[model samples]
Target: MIDAPRSRYQQVADLIREAIQRGDYAPGSALPSQPTLAGKYGINQTSIGKAIALLRREGLVRVIKGKGAYVREIPPISRYAVTRYAEAVRESGTARGAFDAEMAQRGHESRTELVQWGETVAPQVASDALDLTAGAKVAIRKRHMHADDVPVQIATSYVPWELAKGTAIAEQDTGSGGTYSRLAEAGHTVERFTETIRSRMPTPEEADFLRLDEDQPVYDVLHTAWTAEGRAVEICVHVMPTTQWVLHYEWPAS
Candidate 1:
């Protein structure tokens, strides 16, 4: 680590990271509170706050705003040279396809459980990403996706409700199916999706929901699906347990 300025917050973050990398804190362990770190380093609370924020952005720790920080665990890299699982599965002869077939042969049912569904206007971030009015009404769907009933990911999908409103696709009886398939049936072909990957420790609530331990960190994935004509449509964000899933994506030769 470089010798940094006396910027209190960054110093604290560096100390914590050094301790972690040196195995003093160890993975999956919780660090002492801001006050403790502040006192130990003879710094004030505000500096500790800054240090924690830096760590959060660096993906070394995750704080639930009101909750404390915990050490983050690194997810397993795929044996396949891909970036996302969904894309890998779709591409022919992709490593992801072979892996999925093998997993299916062993009888792993990729299932989805409906968690939430409703209509609401877009928040600023979703609106900007989907290019909708800041408060324009949209349809929101949330699902807990699983592999053979084991919780694999929690995804929240947002769509312009006016387009699919009153249709069977947004009805309560769509059952446990993927939103992409349902949207296609509704005449909205999903052409492309962009995803952003980030790392963080799971919140206590998320840990319980996903049946993960304190040691297993979560991967936060934010994605947007667009139509072939270049119109942004559905926006989805998923929090997945890194220990349970591997995401792969393959790019065709240029």
Candidate 2:
């Protein structure tokens, strides 16, 4: 096996990250000061800062102005399938889903909150995801998913508002119903969903909204659900910080 060289800062950050992962520093708890970390590691405070920066990029810790760094939400390992939640619910004839079941079995409870719903997709990012022509109308749905009160995923979805207007699908809140169920009730059966996955650092705004740590890296997942006619009805993008999340998918045999 080839030995990989690691930097002092990386080594220090890994130590701190491991501590955080082991719940030594619980979420919302403060970490030691830069000088303390430097003293403990026998490195310069600058090196400590670099290590903390690494943790921030990995979504492990958030720095406050006077309060120092704090541990934030960490993701649960999720065993997932491409199958829609609605299908799982229907298959089991239960309101809860197989995905939720899997997570609960692992000692994590899944919770979702619908943040916003609107009849327009004004943002360029949302418009593109919905595959709308320039200035085309689209519905906007924003939601957050959590595991044990720690936010794990932040999602926003777009649907052609012109097509969904006056339909019950566009009016429901996250707690009242799921978008998939609403779409089915409104007579658009989702036949398939195509997903694209990527990763990047969260924007400052995203960091604030998702309460992400500076050391945390987020996974960006984009999905589009289509009907049998091949008309795309829903497009969703989810940003999840790595510490608090693992996106598992089982690929069907080719």
Candidate 3:
């Protein structure tokens, strides 16, 4: 039997994508005009257009309105692992240090901008996660995490207002080791954490913040903390862009 021949558009797309991988078309640089590409490939402009579309869908290139197609410029995401919150790491005295340590390894700096805060009636999800119901209020603190000034993740933490009303967790800056530290000081002393993760296409608002294509999805993480007494202390909802993230984890097989 004979192998089927590849389509012209696919062939062109593969060539261009390979060129990108080989750095022939450096990231952040414009590609040759569609007409020029069509001429070089000896194919019609429509074929060239389809080839370019293939590259765009695969995230190898982005076409800004009137800006033409440019190779996408970005570094791979740092692998995020749950172990970063180990006691030894938290001893560094800044909860954010866990994030900084990971990003620093890749030469990327991290920052968090306070986005929303204040007491509010708990959302159904928050209410269920934190053991609150019947319209109980929550102390909601939210922030946008960025890597080198590019927004990467949005996190909103929910704690029962009764426990957080006069605590440092309610403040803009939860001094030193951050919220977890404050929770400990207040006797919550979280003994472990549980994270539930899911993936879905970005909401219109999420797409705008993450600068993602319509096809891109985001990771939704529900991270919760609990004490030895089995009382839930904090529940944080995190929205992370899927393209720019990698997760690492380890466990003893036995």
Candidate 4:
């Protein structure tokens, strides 16, 4: 059976994408206006709009409010490796030390800003992950992670109030080694971590926060840190733009 012909906007979008890739439209350079493109292609202005919208959805372009759409400058790629969780790295007293190392390896800089800090009743999933009863209070440590000022990931950690009550984990800053290192000093050593991830379109607020295209997807990761005694010490949820990160895990062959 023959496949259906591509839609008008799809064809134009593909053409524009090829032009961008071929250096016809340089990165950070604005594309022609919708009316201009429509006239150039002898198509309806709506079709031009639709084509630009498609490009935005693919992250090939970004629309600047009050201005216009421009070809996007793709950022350099970086890896989120399983080895970032190594004890040696965490023990060095920078909870983010692992990420910083990875970024440096790629000639990028890593930074974090504390967004929300204090205590809250553990949300259901966090409650269960930490093995606490529903409604149990937990210290909440929220951060905005960035690569060269480009917002990349939002992380929220839920630690049982019992373990964090008098510790720095409940503060705006986790201090030297980051939360895990501080937890270790407080008798809640993290011996292992497990992460589960899923991808979905971001919520309205999340898209705005991450500065993502309305239709772009984000990866949601649930990370659980466990103690040697088999107790869950921290339950962290990471919201990362799918286009901004790559998760890599290395394991021995079975």
Clashes of 4: 4
The estimated TM-scores of all candidates read 0.53, 0.76, 0.85, 0.82
The local distance difference test score of model 4 is 0.81
Candidate that would win on TM-score: 3
Worst 10 residues of 2 by lDDT: 90-99
| lDDT by residue (tens digit), candidate 1, 147-197 | 655566677767777665775446545433345656677777888878888
- For model 1 the local lDDT of residue 68 reads 80
Error of 4 at 8 (Å): 5.0
Which residue pairs in candidate 4 collide?
Answer: 93-176, 93-177, 94-177, 95-177
Q: For model 3, how does the per-residue alpha-carbon lDDT over 18-37 read when each residue is reduced to its tens digit?
A: 99999999977899999999
C-alpha lDDT values of all predictions: 0.66, 0.72, 0.80, 0.81
Model 1: residues with Cα > 4 Å off, grouped in runs? 1-106, 109-111, 121-125, 175-187, 213-216
Better of 2 and 3 by lDDT: 3
What is the lDDT, from 0 to 100, of the residue 129 in candidate 2? 64
| Residue-level lDDT for 193 in candidate 3 | 83
Candidate 2: residue 219 Cα off by (Å): 2.7
**Stretches of model 2 off by over 4 angstroms after superposition:** 1-7, 21-23, 75-106, 109-111, 125-131, 173-177, 185-187, 213-217
Residue 192's C-alpha lDDT in candidate 2? 87
Clashing pairs for predicted structure model 1, backbone only:
9-51, 82-249, 83-249, 84-248, 84-249, 85-248, 139-161
